[model samples]
Target: MASSRIRTFPQRISGAMAASLGLLALLVTVRCNEQVPVIMWTSEGISLPRQAPPTAGHIVGHQQLASYLEKALDVGPRNVVLFLQDKMSIEDFTLYGGAFGNKQDGVFPNLEGALRSSSSPLVLPAVSWPASNAVIGQLQDQLDTSPLYMDPDTLSQLRLNASSPALLVFRLPYGTGSDLLSAKETLSGNDEVIGQVISIMRSQAVPYTAVYTGLQPSRKEAAALSVEGGLGGGRSLLQSRGGYKDRWRNRERQQWAKEKREVYAPVEFKEDDRTCMLLWAKGLTVGILRNNRWEEHDLTPATFGEGVSPRLHGSDCDKSKARLVLNYENVLGHRSFKLVFVMSQRHYKVSARRWFTLDAVELEYDGTKATFNGSRSIYAPAEYSYRCHSVTSFRWPLLVPRSAKDPANQWRVSFDDFQIQGFNLSGNEFSYASDCAGFFSPGIWMGLLTSLLMVLVLTYGLHMIMQLLTMDRFDDPKGPGISVPQTE
Candidate 1:
């Protein structure tokens, strides 16, 4: 009985171990198959009709107007009349012109020629020009005021109740009282569209010219004038009359100069005339204690250099056993802090390549110093990739006391995105200028390979173990010895 018990003991232990592994795999499968709720419940939601936002119209400047006139007159002799109308939008013009002609093959025909040929009742008058003496005199008179502005007498001659192949210049008044819309309505009533008047000069046969100026905020500004006093009032407040656009530009300049005087810049420290150690962060941010809460403040490259000082101590060329101290002061509105990085060099087990590792982090802040002792330590290799921004960011959540002896009343300080470089470095400039290394790191691939190898080894060992399950020698005192049958 003792011999039988000893032989079966190993089998019982093997069965129990296999059962536990099977249960573990089953639980993992169940956990993976679990579905997370996307939406727990639904409620009645209000549906509102959507309305498009009002868009402003673009107006051509004086230079563009001159370019258009020069191009139009260069083609042939044509009467050119430029209309400078305010409060009329380009959208209104495009829409009203489309109603005149039926679109041919899903595209509108040249509406300009169509409108001009049918212009029997539309009133656009002709102006007669004289020799160079009168032309040069008129040009010289309006040059001081506005070259585009014509006197009311010249403009008054443009009123003919019927349409003629003549130029008509209309200086539509701004504000709520505008005559341009009424003129547009009159042209539409006469079965003539006013929008396509510009394209009439595009053809050689056409002899008339109409220039349209689509201005904004007059039609739209009527609504905003009551609510905002004026459309430009808010913008004028940001930019003062003195032409200074930046309201805090001078204050920022002064603060930068003050910060320049407060902190020392980083300098390259040469060790044993062999290697150089210089540290700097591309980005830095700190949580400042304000109003019993933490407010975030980002430090620019200039401000970061003015506030933080990097120093290397110890005489190790690899900088593995050296101490890297990053002292920050006059930052976060004069809050001083120090970070000590204890580094070490580690090599991959399968390769000759080596990289640096952060062994520990010692923080000094709020008049108290503490070494961070946590379950998660920075044991991974310091990422180093050529031409990449392979930064190793460190975040430390620290407790700062309010007073010297006040333990309960403490403020939490968070240091985030403290990306430090130049660990175990030797050169004039920094390295790793772009993104980090690839997604599946070497360590992750190694782990997956190792797990697969372990599974294969376990499978083979179980197969060999199963082959060893031969029945114990059983001899019967009969004619022949009975053997246990092997069943798969």
Candidate 2:
């Protein structure tokens, strides 16, 4: 009995080991399966919208539709419709109010009629994208079959083989609507046509799923549409710049003296504008620190809610220093975020021509500041311009928490379309500083010194070789100038 027990113990141990290995393999398999689909269904140029289409009842994800199709295949021969309409917005549909709370009438009458009749029609909002080759390839990969491309206008001619599951993809023609109401009518007609086709499919007892893709309209078009027949929401739509709001908005409401400024102050240039410094800055952008990096946030009218507006200060000329301040109310949890730039201006001579130099620059944001005091001495080269200078890339680092230890984790701010005038600038011509390469860097100087040393060594060696004349010390006096053989 003892011998039998010992034999079974090893057998039981082997079985346990095998079960653990199987479990490990299953975990690895699940991980691999989870990772593979993300890469497989990964697409580019597809932006999940921030706001839901007001008219599209609900939006469905690509994965959700794909999963539904996969399951529907098991039920019976499935007919899936992927209707990709071009440049259609959810606001165009009479289903919901437009982006600015405009009353949208029945733009999709036929489609609405069909939806009313159907018990459970799968109509959900999707992002607007034209059917690209990549999208087609993705669909093919998911369905394990090439989609039969058919025109939505000629859907009556679509002949799908009922024996096999069909993935029907219809790409409507691009709309040429001149105005908003026309655009609405055009989109409505498309929806009606598609809806009529869907109703026919239902009558044929074919199990079908329909998807409608819509675009977000441009500000220009929205404005034009608002003028034609839209409610006053068009102005609001044009002013909409999407961003997250922080708690600083309440603080900004109480503090009005520090934040209010003119949106646009006329730029004045004098005939002899040498004493003052004027800086013009457009397109203000703010960067917020997140995950130890600077994430860009475009400062817009809508970013700080309805009442507060972002304004640019410092259009007026200053005698001593040029100051340009971009103030944002309620930005990144701050009640007032000001990007202040102070540049000290001076007149100088360059190549017998009168030029101006910005000797020093001080940039301040939040609580930290980056000051660059340029060399103004005659010995050191400085950036001196004859006219106005424009800089597109002026980036400054902000002192963040981890930045003290790791420079790579620092946050930075950037400026664009920045111009400094009042330095004898005439007309539209700009003159940049010639001394961009101020001095040789340490590495360059080292390389130059190494090259000079090599040249000196080679020259010395050549001189020594020239001086090494072989003397005819071997005098053949006995042999009457008989020279020894050159080579023995």
Which residue pairs show backbone clashes in model 1? Answer: 122-163, 388-432, 388-433, 388-434, 389-434
Q: Could you give candidate 2's per-residue lDDT for residues 449-481 as a string of tens digits?
A: 999999999999999999987876676667777
Per-residue CA lDDT of candidate 1, range 364-387, in tens? 566766454211333333433122
* Root mean square deviation (Cα) for candidate 1: 35.6
For each of the candidates, give the backbone clash count: 5, 0
Query: Candidate 2, residue 125: CA error in Å?
Result: 4.0
After superposition, the stretches of candidate 1 with alpha carbons farther than 4 Å from their true spots are 1-267, 288-292, 297-319, 330-336, 348-352, 370-424, 431-488
lDDT of all predictions:
0.37, 0.41
lDDT of 1 at 174: 34
